[model samples]
Target: MSSIDIQHPHTLAPAKARKAVEEVAKKLAERFDVEYGWVGDTLNFSRSGVDGKIALQPNQLHVSAQLGFLLGALKGPIESEIRRVLEERFK
Candidate 1:
C-alpha cells in the first residue's frame, strides 16, 4: 500500500472550512465514486481501492489516505490532483 498525508493550512473559519470540505466531498463522490461522512470534525471517505480521512481544524486540513496495490502505483498523480483541488478550494 501507498500512503498520502498532507497538511494544508487555511485561513477560513471552522464553519466555512467545513462547507468547503463538503463541496470537495461532493465532487469526489461524483467523480470518483467515493463515499464519505463526517464524524466530529473529521470527514472519512472510502472507495474501491482507497480509504482516507480529511480532518478539519479552524486553520488547517489534514488529508490522509491509503491506496491499495494497483492504485498505489498511481499515487503521484492522485496526490497531485488532491493538492490541486485543495489549493483551488482553500485558497
Candidate 2:
C-alpha cells in the first residue's frame, strides 16, 4: 500500500475542528466510497481500496492515508484531492 501523510497547525477550537472534520469525512465518504468515523478527537476512514486516519489536535491536524492500488495508479490525484478538500474546508 502507498501512504500519504500531512500535518499542519490550525487555530480553530476543538468543537469546530471536529465539526469540520466530520463534514469533510462525509463529503469524502459520499464522493469516494470511503467509510469514516470519529475516534475521540480523531477521524478514521477506510474504503474498499483505501485506508486512512485523520486526527485533530489543539493546534494541529494530521492526516495519514494509504491506497492499496499501485503507487502510480491513484496516489497523487487522491492525495491532491484530499489536500484540496481539507484546505478548502479548514481554512
Candidate 3:
C-alpha cells in the first residue's frame, strides 16, 4: 500500500471551506464512485481501492489517504491531481 499526506493552507472561512470540500467530495463521488461523509470538521472517504480523510483546520486542510496495490502504482499522478484540485479550489 502507498500513503499520501498533504497539508494545504487556505484563507477561506470555516463554513465556506466546508462547502468547498462538499463540492469536491460530490465531484469525487460522481467521477470516482467514492463514498464520503463528514465527521465534525473532517470528511472521510473511501472506495474499493482507497480510503482517506480530509481534516479541516482553521488555516489548513490535511489530506491523508491509503492506496491499494493497483492504485499505489499510480500514486504520483493521483497525488498531483489532488494537489491541483486543492490549488484550484482553495485559492
Query: Which candidate leads in lDDT?
Result: 3
Q: After superposition on all CA atoms, how large is the RMSD of candidate 3? A: 0.4
- Per-model TM against the reference: 0.96, 0.88, 0.98
Give the higher-TM-score candidate: 1 or 2: 1
Give the per-residue lDDT digits (tens) of candidate 3, residues 1-91: 9999999999999999999999999999999999999999999999999999999999899999999999999999999999999999997
Error of 1 at 38 (Å): 0.4
lDDT of each: 0.95, 0.81, 0.98
TM-score of 2: 0.88
lDDT of 2 at 23: 86
Q: Per-residue lDDT for 85 in model 1? A: 88
Error of 2 at 19 (Å): 0.3
What is the per-residue lDDT of model 1 for residues 1-91, given as tens digits with 9 covering 90 to 100? 9999999999988999999999999999999899999999999999999999999976889999999999999999999999998898887
Q: Sort by lDDT, best first: what order?
A: 3, 1, 2
Ten contiguous residues minimizing lDDT sum, candidate 2? 65-74
Tens digits of per-residue lDDT, candidate 2, 11-84, equal 88889988888888888778878788778888899877777888998788899977776643878887788778
Off by over 4 Å in 3: none
